[model samples]
Target: GPQIHRRTLLLTAYSGPVFFHILFYYCQAFIYGTTFQHTASQILAFTLITLHFAKRIFETIFVHVFYRLTVSFYSLYLYLFHYWLLSGVFMAYYIYYPGTCSSSISLLSSALETEETSLYFLSAVWIFAELSNFETHLILANLRIRYPRPIPKGYGFDLVSCPNYFFELLAWTVITLITRSLASLLFLIAAGLHMWRKAARKHEMYKKEFGSQYPKYRKVLIPYV
Candidate 1:
């Protein structure tokens, strides 16, 4: 009981920092608006922070109850991977089509030469992310319904290995593209590295635990056919 309680407390405290940052940034956004470039950074920062906190909170509050344990490795992977890929893409776009805003309020103005292109790209990214998110949830639900207990030995292949991590990465990649700031890019990279390591660890654990019986079908980071 103490171990379980300690685990829960650790999860909550680990995520509390990001949650606090989200609240702080949100309050600042409301007060300052988005007319200035600084506000753009603020928005991006808060968005990243919120996403991190939300992912952790969801896993802590719901996934544990539904799935019987926190998806610790998956959560880390999702948080970092999405941000890294998206931030790189956004940085590239920013270099090619640089624009300036007078203030946070004017940040959304269509004043850049490639405004239309950027908008279209962002929309497409959002749509893709949402689709991925939906698919991931579907997979998770299927796993929980079909395989309730100690995942069948070697049957891990049928389980939704790490669908959430894949989609989570995709979502942040889109976010980085939408808000191409150096700060955002840095954050993404930092988060990505952290998560990648965790994913690797999880992969190793599954392999060791399941041995040859583990579904040969399931890949660590991707879905196994």
Candidate 2:
């Protein structure tokens, strides 16, 4: 099968989702004017989904270095839909649900009791996990520049083959918790499974490439694996 550079595929893939999310979120105005109001959770999902892809696009351009060079472009369809179209469609479904479009119908209300507190807590966790993921990417990007210098293990580089994947999954889980949306949960599961496989392969590659130099106890996106 034909392949494309990782950077190009990543940019194309993530960019698709960002566009879809924006379109779906603002469709009320575009398609029906300001006549419709979205629930607070819908708006929050829109923001976080946008922010998540924006971060990935930024990392693809500036933070990640391509060791593998290319991957199948078929992955572009899977990833593009995975990020943008899937989220947008799910979001559109919930946002456009009959008589449930008002802020009063907040999806966060699903959390019971501590809705506001829980939303805030999960949001804080999302921010932390996303930043942690970005930090790990920075470490990987610096690995070549830092050369003979010991790589930083403070971010759990020694505990997992891909702390970035763990953090990425954590961020998705936060969104799922905050929205309590089946849609977001579905996306999380898809992403988790995909990253889990990729992480395992990367872990194996690291072992074969660096052997004794790679951290001995490091696992693949999990501890005690």
TM-score: which candidate is best? Answer: 2
Across 1-225, the per-residue lDDT of candidate 1 in tens digits comes to 112343364354546545445433434345334422333434443454356556555655554435344445444544344433333333322322224221232243345435445545555665665556555555455555673334422222355355556555666565555555564456556656665666667667667776786566666554553
For model 1, where is the 10-residue window of minimal lDDT?
95-104
Give the runs in model 2 whose Cα sits over 4 Å from its true position. 29-34, 95-113, 145-152
C-alpha lDDT of candidate 1 relative to the true structure: 0.48
- TM-score of each predicted structure versus truth: 0.50, 0.82
Runs in model 1 lying further than 4 Å from the true structure = 1-59, 66-114, 130-160, 215-218, 222-225
Model 2: per-residue Cα lDDT over 1-225, one tens digit each? 989888998888778767766676667656445556666655676778789989999999988887689998788777767765665566545544433423332454555445566566677888999999999989888885675645347686879988999999999887776566667778788888999999999889878877688888888997777
Cα RMSD, each candidate: 8.6, 3.5
Reference-based lDDT, each prediction: 0.48, 0.75
